[model samples]
Target chain A: MRDHLAFRLAYRGTAFKGFQFQKNVVTIQAKVEEAFARYFKESRRVHFGSRTDAGVHAYDHFVYFPKAFELYTALGVSKRKSFLSSLNFMLGNDIRIWEFGRLSSNFNVMEDIVSKSYSYFILSSPVEDPILTEYFHWIRHSLNLRAMRKAQRQILGTHNFACFAKSSGVSVRNSERGTTRRIYKASIVSRLHPQMKIGQILEFKFEGSGFLRHMVRNMVGTLVQVGEGKGTNIKSILRSGSRLEAGPNLPANSLFLTGTKIRAGLYAPLRPQTE
Target chain B: MRDHLAFRLAYRGTAFKGFQFQKNVVTIQAKVEEAFARYFKESRRVHFGSRTDAGVHAYDHFVYFPKAFELYTALGVSKRKSFLSSLNFMLGNDIRIWEFGRLSSNFNVMEDIVSKSYSYFILSSPVEDPILTEYFHWIRHSLNLRAMRKAQRQILGTHNFACFAKSSGVSVRNSERGTTRRIYKASIVSRLHPQMKIGQILEFKFEGSGFLRHMVRNMVGTLVQVGEGKGTNIKSILRSGSRLEAGPNLPANSLFLTGTKIRAGLYAPLRPQTE
Candidate 1:
């Protein structure tokens, strides 16, 4: 009987290429595999819940792999706390293992997803703040929040998001699943920055059953244009199903994967067992 | 007759070596002077209210220099707003000139100082946070907040801070001004971090008539030892006037020059004139 382990982690994506495995570039997956190889002295493949883009941060995310129980015994990791600490020590400061536990061998990290929440931060000001440069996208002018919110309302419920996705040369007609996705919630809010007095930070939050590649970013870009009084017709853009009708994709640095829910109740146990 | 200009600026000190000008290395003063030279085509020396160390951020600080009013006209910077925007473009994103105005030539930025406020941030957690790595010092264990506050009370009022000063081989007897200084306020507060849920960010704030070299960092280091139940006698350390008796100087990255009050009322005018 093979035992599996699941991990919920957070990472600052400034130093990583992305969460995917690639050749010759530093990535989150590569680092995790490297740490596992160094600690367990065995090669193992890990599956991620989502493949986040380059420079996209994550406050809550998931990964799972087969656990070598004998290796844990040999390494004296009797508790989940020891296992997390030892793996984190090898993973460096950029990524943190927030929680980990034993899972059934048949548990699938990717297929069990129920919902995903993402947050995009925007600093609306004439000048960029040095301290927040890595985490916020700076705009030179103030945005029309009312208009953006009005546009956000159109994103709720199921819609064919082919227009918002990056074209992969595969026609939507030929794709089995197509580009339809259910957006559970979409909203925007502006708040005073704690450090910068002159600017407001706008948070664009979205929760959905699933999203197409570049969907959230493209939607935000379109809403930003609406906020700028560009007179963008988001409804028509969705109806047209043309990528050209959507606004440009925003930068990934300001985007964050805030939360994810799984059918297996992976995040239900907030506190790891000490024993 | 020479017109003087005064600027209130904020900076994130990650890329700067220090505020003072030095040869062959990057410093805040060096960057400012370079920007001035590039824009005005002249070399001008700037006087800073406080000379902050490398990796120390400042939200409110002062600098003054003789204004090249003629150069502003020559460069088509007719308004103060234009002057600021143009200069900031040259200074890059690390430093921002928040306010600038005409100052009396006799106004001395350094000697007219009434008070200076500094804030130091510490994150007490088992592991370091990657996002806050540039701005906070991470401690592995929980600190005794009550004990730290108790130690903070001893720092108020006039005291000889010679022990906290970095020794320059010049004895106190040979110095023109002794290390005696007046501290108006010393406080420690712990608050939940906005992003990181696992750790509490402790803020140590100090306000004084003046501070000696390495004074704030040294004081914080000693307070940390006391919080760790080291039973550090701050009174004895001050009385001995020995650097070795105090705690180790904390890292500069976590320290910030929050504000400065000038006897000349440099900060009295909150808004800069558009004309």
Candidate 2:
């Protein structure tokens, strides 16, 4: 088996079930692994940096394939299907491989100590942008940006975020494995332009050491409640450490994994961070 | 029927057949007319400022609906479905009405003395962006931007652009009427970002006093040829005034009617022009 290959990819998450493999339903991992078997004539499992929910887009999703790298190097003599091009060609219309490179054999996409950033987009107004419906979450009522900003500040530190996660409805060990996660940064910004007459697009960004299942969505839902003037005491909710105290979880369609900051010298940063 | 109503609208044209009304086909005009009939209990013939082909998006497509305004004013008791919101609620997810206003009784959408702007996006790379596949016209080979710029300048002034129009096979009048059009501004811009690893997005903008059928698409097709080093004597093609001399017409998906520059008192400008 080949070793030491990392791929930076992006996909529109509307079509697949999620990042994980499934039995009968289609998923991102299934499609990608099938592509590998078909194009490279090998079947190796792929490891993802983060497990995304259904309908959550990722602009910087990472994957590690040990045997795929060896297949690329060994097939260098043939020009039929180079590593990146061949895989991209075989994948469906919703997934794209942006960059690929050789990494240290020790590199692990899941356990790498770094940060990741996610953004949730909300279109606030009754007016609809038909062309952008898939990209934005349309909320008919106006949201209080000032209140949401204050709520974001209240949750920007190390805390036992048990309340922000959903119950797995199975064995509870998976949900309790890592409940104490750190929030490095959290803010809400408006991306509205003057030409946009009817509504405004508010982008909420969260950067953290790690995230729990549905944690970001639940936080966004709570922040939205604060913006709606429904939740006044956000610190109490955090202090309560109760999932019932938090607001409902937001939909996954509007969430995006925008960037991932990995350790130095592992791989080149995809783009310069403006913020 | 109410007389003085103008609507500024936009739609993602991937679903509809075209802008015009047809007997059995699903079209933007038919949808809008159906919405008016359903919401206002009246059917009125809608006139569009421009006729768009299938899969052509519009940022600011204007339409004049005579009965829609009457319905709003007559049913002015309810603020909930006011004029714009009522129609928007009735329309499908692929269409949106951005703005509506009362106009002069003599104002006509097709006869207005103004200019229109169009933008065509080209993703010049072999690798595809799955998220952006529906929006951009992907070209695998490298294009000569300098050569295309030169070709754009040659077709800029008042000219008989018969050479750059698609000929309707059935009748000659379809291609002959209003063939003389004025080109106000023409330029090619690069929307490339530092983070983009593989492809470059080139935006071609064309502002003209008027356009013939398929004029913009034909011009884009010819410019692409010049960029590909296939067409050098573009001035001769213009001098010849023959449709056979120009390149083929491009697809409709990549073209967008960015905005229209109407009379100063007609409507508000949608966005600031960077150039």
TM-score per prediction, in order, is 0.89, 0.89
The number of clashing residue pairs in each candidate reads 0, 2
DockQ of 1: 0.30
Candidate 1, residue B23: how far the Cα is off, in Å: 1.9
DockQ scores of the candidates: 0.30, 0.36
- The interface root-mean-square deviation of each model, in the order shown, is 4.3, 9.2
Chain B TM-score of candidate number 2: 0.88
Off by over 4 Å in 1: A1-3, A67-81, A104-106, A168-177, A264-275, B1-3, B67-81, B168-177, B263-275
Please give the TM-score of chain B in predicted model 1: 0.89
Docking class of 1: acceptable
Tens digits of per-residue lDDT, candidate 1, A1-275, equal 76666676789988899899999999999988898888777898887768898899987777777765445545543654467678889999899876665555655654567789999999987556777788889886788899999999998999889899886322567544578878999999798655545667999999998777788889999999999999999999999988999998999999988887777643333333222
